[model samples]
Target: MTLEKKQPTPTAKPTADDEIDLIALAKTLWDGRRKIMFYLLAGAILGLVFALASPKEYTANTTMIPQTGSSVASKLGGLSSLASLAGVNMSNVGDKESLPPTIYPQIIQSIPFQVELMNTPFKCPDVDQPVSLYDYYIDYKKAGVLENVKKYTLGLPGLLLGVLKGEQEEGALLDSTLASSLISLTEDQDKVVKILNEQISLEINDKEGYISLSSRFNDALLAAQVTRKTQSMLQDYISRYKLDKANEQLKFIEARYAEKKAEFELIQNELAIFRDRNKYITTATASTQLEQLQTQYNLAYTIYSDWAKQLEQAQVQVKENTPFLTIIEPVRVPLEKSKPNRPLILIIWIFLGGIIGTGTVFGQELYNSVKERWSE
Candidate 1:
């Protein structure tokens, strides 16, 4: 007798909610509370270790306002006049000197400028040590031993060294053997220049035509010195270039005026002599010659007068119209460090760590459940 094989009732398909039983998950995690605690403890330790290993950063800030004074009109006019004559329309002619407040920052923060700074001495405060600012930046680029250890622990140790150090020498190796590093300069959409590192931040406020040059460094004295030197460099740039064209123009006008005056005087003297000699000699021919001489003298005198007026205007314009720059408020030494916001950083780190930990725990549990079901 072919007995109809009773089809086994298909196991009730697990619904979406039933697949991940919240009550079961809570029980599983709670039953493995020790394992969970181990993970939490490890995360907390990582946070604490990272917090200690991280370098403290400092920031220095200063505001610059356009200086208000008597020189504005003259400087602005001079720049405009020169540009206008040259067929160049300067956008900020009525405002600050173009070189100082406008073009100077671009020049100063350029690669060549940074290379120049590299050759010069700059002072910066170290983590309980003192260093030249150049060296400070170089050192800041290095991965600290503790930082290396953490990175290795996180499975993201950098190339070259990770293969060399591996897990064995995580925090033991020194970074002094590496080549000296340089600070990177970047500009934002708002045109603010940033020279940054983990330990220091320099934010340049270039909005008011006066650069509010701010920097973060450990040393107050060094911060002040940097700010002052930056300003000086900016001035040096302007003094070298902006005044050159104006001075050249003035010199040219002065020479031309002198030459024109000399010629005018000579023509006047010639006309006077002709009149003195020919006044009483009343021939029709002499009268005609006198009239002709007078006409030439008048023309020469008019030309000379126009030249004289131009010279006066040129001189006034040079004196008044030179785009001048003056520091409104000089940067002061910063008293407080700008970085190492402990609470904020800790909160962020905790949140990130929690997410990673939770993901790992759940991912492992899901994989185990799927494997068991498939095996059955």
Candidate 2:
């Protein structure tokens, strides 16, 4: 009867052997302190070398506000209905023809644009000469000893691949006018283009209708000059594109005006000769002939006058459609370098080194633990 009342015993809690010991982990890290310090010191030294070896870059920036044709809508108002009848929508057509500020950056970064920019002449104060970007990159940009070491060490694989590919012949430099139609590039030109792309930057603010163009180079003066040139080129290109239709219309009008003027003059001269020849003649036939010549001259003169007015209007339209780039902030030579922040670079290196060292320590501990378990 008493055995029925017996109680079940509780299992004992797991002992400390199954739990982690923070103290022991700390001791292990302490034992590896020297190794960590050595690794960290090595990393810091490497960072210092890299920071010192890095080339200095100066940046030049310019801001431009795009002035679109304001009177375009009014100018096309009379033709709006005609356009609609012809199945062409004229609503907001002016806005459509004018490029948005957002596209400015893309245009600058385009291959043809970059190619033309590379060939643009820039005066470099450091080199004491005016040179194209291609020439400047190849001939004037001297690498430091540390940079040479990195090229052979860190960039060894790329160097070997380039060597295997063999050297490529330089292509003829393209002019702005010719470069617009270029579809391809030579190996040397491609290399220069890649570098040019990296050096140039464009920022567009559509809401404000402004664009900021910047160029970075080792020489301050060159950076400013290149940025200025790029801005000018972009303005010219956009203006030409916007006014292209207007210009063609103007040319046609001028030609027609010339033709009409000659016809009007000839008709007037024929009428005058008829009057002079028929002076004091009262015959019905002579009067009819003179009247017909006079009527022809009047028609020709009216047509010529209309064409002359049209020619003047076309000229005005071309001028009105021409886009203007208002320079909000002009490019200026930078007095200070834009890149190579030595202190920041050094700090980044130190932090990376610490991480590597910590990882190494934990990896060693893990290896030791696995080995001990295997022995057991």
Candidate 3:
């Protein structure tokens, strides 16, 4: 049986169907070149149209270096320990209260800040006259066709809901009286705020102690104005926050000083009257009365003097606590458009079109292969 099995075993040869043919695949793609080119051309044309229709935006930027008053910390140094012992926290003591540059972005995005910005009048190139940003956005601004298309497509649900709700009455959802409270925002106000938020940007460099503020708008001058206004508003807000305690102290001191001054003056007048009326008397009871009046005058004068010094000190503290914003690079009108990068847009479109065309060609091949297999 072993001798019979000594015959040679035949080796299996590879079949043509099992081998991959790159040339054939290439030919298949070449056969659909027209379809591929058509898709690519369509994509490119759409991109060009979008690029042409897109609105131009101008960006204006300003750089600033915040001047932190370390003197405030020094002034509060002695009080910090006392405050801690009394279970009262003091932030200004030992650089604790000094806001970091990072929080600046939050300040710009704050509701109160946005409200003020919206109410601010901006010079628009398209408009014959300057208009408040709120009015400009709400009344005059027109959405582009593409923007409307996107709204109807991606934002359809929201749009439909808004329509169902009907035109909201002014102040129906928002309490304008609470604007000073900053606790709430109305729907209209919120919309304007959101728009403002999109238009403004803040960049902080903590290590360098500098900040860059930027604003984008349809008009170059308006963009520059907005940037400058934002810087001013930020400076004002920070200054008010920094000097809050000092201002309160000053107010109290001023009120006390006024009361003391009036009391002192009244006492002086009384003392003078006593002296004038009792002139040349030379009696023990009269001398005693004179001494009593003199004593009262001295006490009132002393209290008034002390408060005067305190009032002066409080005034100094207010001045010292006021923060200064040193503008490194002031805002200027942009000469060039900041957005609508046409060339880049065109390139991206072409690249996407090529990808889509290639995918279409391969997808067609896959569909045909599946169909043939199913038929078999």
Best by TM-score: 3
lDDT of 3: 0.79
Residue 150 of model 1 has an lDDT of 68
Judged by lDDT against the true structure, how good is candidate 1?
0.57
Clashing pairs in model 2, backbone N/Cα/C closer than 3 A: none
Point out where model 2 deviates above 4 Å: 1-20, 70-73, 82-96, 144-150, 153-158, 168-184, 249-311, 319-323
Question: Model 3: which ten-residue window has the lowest total lDDT?
Answer: 11-20
Q: Residue by residue across 1-376, what tens digits does model 1's lDDT show? A: 8999898655655654576687778876676566556666676776776676666654555555433333232533444444344344545323433343455456666665554444456555444554444555555446566657766676564555657865443223335444235343322211122343222223345553445665555456776766666656655556555456445556755775686678768878988898888769769998888888787677666656655665676576556643244556667776676656666666666666666666677778889889999999
Off by over 4 Å in 3: 1-20, 71-73, 76-96, 168-186, 248-313, 320-323
Q: How are the candidates ranked when ordered by lDDT, highest leading?
A: 3, 2, 1
Write down the lDDT of every candidate, Cα atoms only.
0.57, 0.77, 0.79
**Measured by C-alpha RMSD in angstroms, how accurate is candidate 3?**
8.7
Mind giving the per-residue lDDT tens digits that candidate 3 earns over 1-376?
3665575544333334334466667887798899888878987898898888888899999999987655443554354454354344546334434556778899999888898888998887667788989888888889887888898999999989989988766556656676555466667678889888999999989788788999998779989999999999999888877688567656765886797789889989999998889889779999998898898788777667766776677688777745467888989999999988988887788878888888889898999999999999
TM-score of each: 0.58, 0.71, 0.72
